[model samples]
Target: MYGCEWDDETGATNGFFQDGYDGEDFLSLDLKEMRWISPVQQGFLTVQKWNKDTANTEYQKQYLSTVCIEWLQKYLQYGKSSLQKTVPPHVSLLQKSSSSPVTCHATGFYPNEVKISWMRNDEDHDEDVDLGELLPNEDGTFQKMSTIRVTPDELKKNQFSCVVEHQGKTIKKTLTDDSLPIGIIVGALAAVVLLVVISVVVFKVYQKKKGFKPVSASDDGSNSSAHSDAKA
Candidate 1:
């Protein structure tokens, strides 16, 4: 009979080979029945190991790919909705062209993390730009706003630009100047001012008319006669 154990704890597999060994550490060919079962069991074990290894490899690949996609999305700021880890920052320029110095305000920026600045040509804007509040995103990033005072000349040559920097990436957007038809706006305002002035004058004239009273000479005859007597 052959002695064999199928588990390490019980010394099953090795036990069979150990007890079945001949005078040397080798087994004799006459121990066919005992050795035969080993080949079958080894085949089964090999198949099981191959399946487990394949499954583990596939899982690792999938996990690594997912991690890579997430890492890229944090900086890319654009792409698949599922991979949209960061919201792209937006900016708008607000201008009051009629004011002495045209006012430019910029709003909307994201990861909520960034710095905003204004430039004239390419110089640092000192008093020209007023930085506003830095808002936060739900994801813990930051958003900041800023405004700049631009002169007519700057607006004309398109010398002003708004710059945003985040995570070492810089984005610059050229400022746009929307022409306000001064003639039309001023004409309309003038028409209104004229209307107001005319209304005021008319009101005054109406009050004068309401307060005026005609005096009759016949009612003042006694006073006039006394004045004539004194003169005489």
Candidate 2:
């Protein structure tokens, strides 16, 4: 492999050309000395032959130092738009249940650099906190999750929040009762109500199909006896 390195801040440049054999260093080009160096015995003859070729060595040096750097700069210029693009993260607080840890989840961010932490009463809190790994999204974005274990009472007595830092922006999510998985409870209640309504409908349909009539409590015995006399 051969390449050039450029330091934009320091305006420093360096180049190297190295060859390996069977995962071991075989030969390397020394730009400063304008010679080939061989660390292994098998490459000694090859290095000697290469070092004697002054014209080829000069060309190699020129390509590594000048031409390679020019191509690298051109590539960087051509892809600057995508290389420097930044997308802010969308963060949320999630929990499986009241007894579970609260996770600060951030997703749909670009560049994959992010920081997640917990804060209590406006101060950093790291106890019982677990930081998750940065993961990739299907849309070329990134995601991460950080969780904190705290009791319900602690949440009520103090202010707890999840903070995420990405793309020079800060996002915070405060722990609230609304953040709890109350939707699960509401969904369960709704299911029970639906079941009761279905049962009532089914029972009414069965009664109608069986020709069953409901007896009223207001019917008198005299009315019943007159009906019987008429029948006689």
Candidate 3:
């Protein structure tokens, strides 16, 4: 394997060139000394032969120090935008049921580095907390979840919150009835109302198409005679 490393802050660069035989180190280049180093006796002869070629050694040193560094810089410049980008996460507190643990889920964040913890009354709480593994999202972002087990009585007596630290920002979600699936209930009710409205509209359209009219108690027998003539 051979590669170059660059330190942007210090402007320092280094390179390495190595060869292996049968899963053992055979020959390696020492960039500082401009020489080939061999760890085993079998490679001593090959190392001696390579060391005698001063012209080639000088060429190798120049290529590793200058040419390799230039290529590395170009690659870094091409990928700078994607490598340095940061995206904040969307945080949510979720619970399946009253007896289940509350999960704090954070998703759609970039860079994959985050911290999740629990707090009680503004203080850190670690008991009965489970930290989930970092997962990848389909959009090239990341997601994570942390769950805390607490009783309903304890939640009502104290303020419990989930804290998420990501991309230099902090998000806190408090445990409350709002965290439950209330939105689902509202959506279901809305669907039912919509269905009732549609049914009423259809019924009115059918009545209109069939030439139906409201019959009042005071209507004369003329309306009944007209209906009988139409049926005939």
Best by TM-score: 2
Worst 10-residue stretch by lDDT in candidate 3? 177-186
Better model by lDDT: candidate 1 vs candidate 2: 2
Deviating ranges (above 4 Å) for candidate 1: 1-84, 100-109, 137-142, 178-232
What TM-score does candidate 2 get on C-alpha atoms? Answer: 0.62
lDDT of each: 0.54, 0.87, 0.88
Candidate 1: minimum summed lDDT over ten consecutive residues — where? 27-36
Where does the lowest 10-residue lDDT sum fall in candidate 2? 177-186
Task: Give the runs in model 3 whose Cα sits over 4 Å from its true position.
Answer: 1-7, 10-69, 177-232
- Pitting candidate 1 against candidate 3, the one with the higher lDDT is 3
Model 2 C-alpha lDDT versus the unseen true structure:
0.87
Question: Which pairs of residues collide in candidate 3?
Answer: none
Q: Of 2 and 3, which scores higher on TM-score?
A: 2
lDDT of 1 by residue, 1-232 (tens): 3222233255322222221324333221112322222223334554355345655545434443454345444444554553334545665555544344433333343445677777777876666667778766555555666767666666778577787776567778776556563445667799999999999799789878899543444548886676666669
**Candidate 3, 85-156: lDDT as tens digits:** 899999988776766788899999989999999999999999999999999999999999998998887887
After superposition, the stretches of candidate 2 with alpha carbons farther than 4 Å from their true spots are 1-4, 14-62, 182-232
For model 1, name the residue pairs that clash: 4-16, 5-12, 5-13, 6-12, 111-141, 112-141, 112-142, 112-143, 113-142
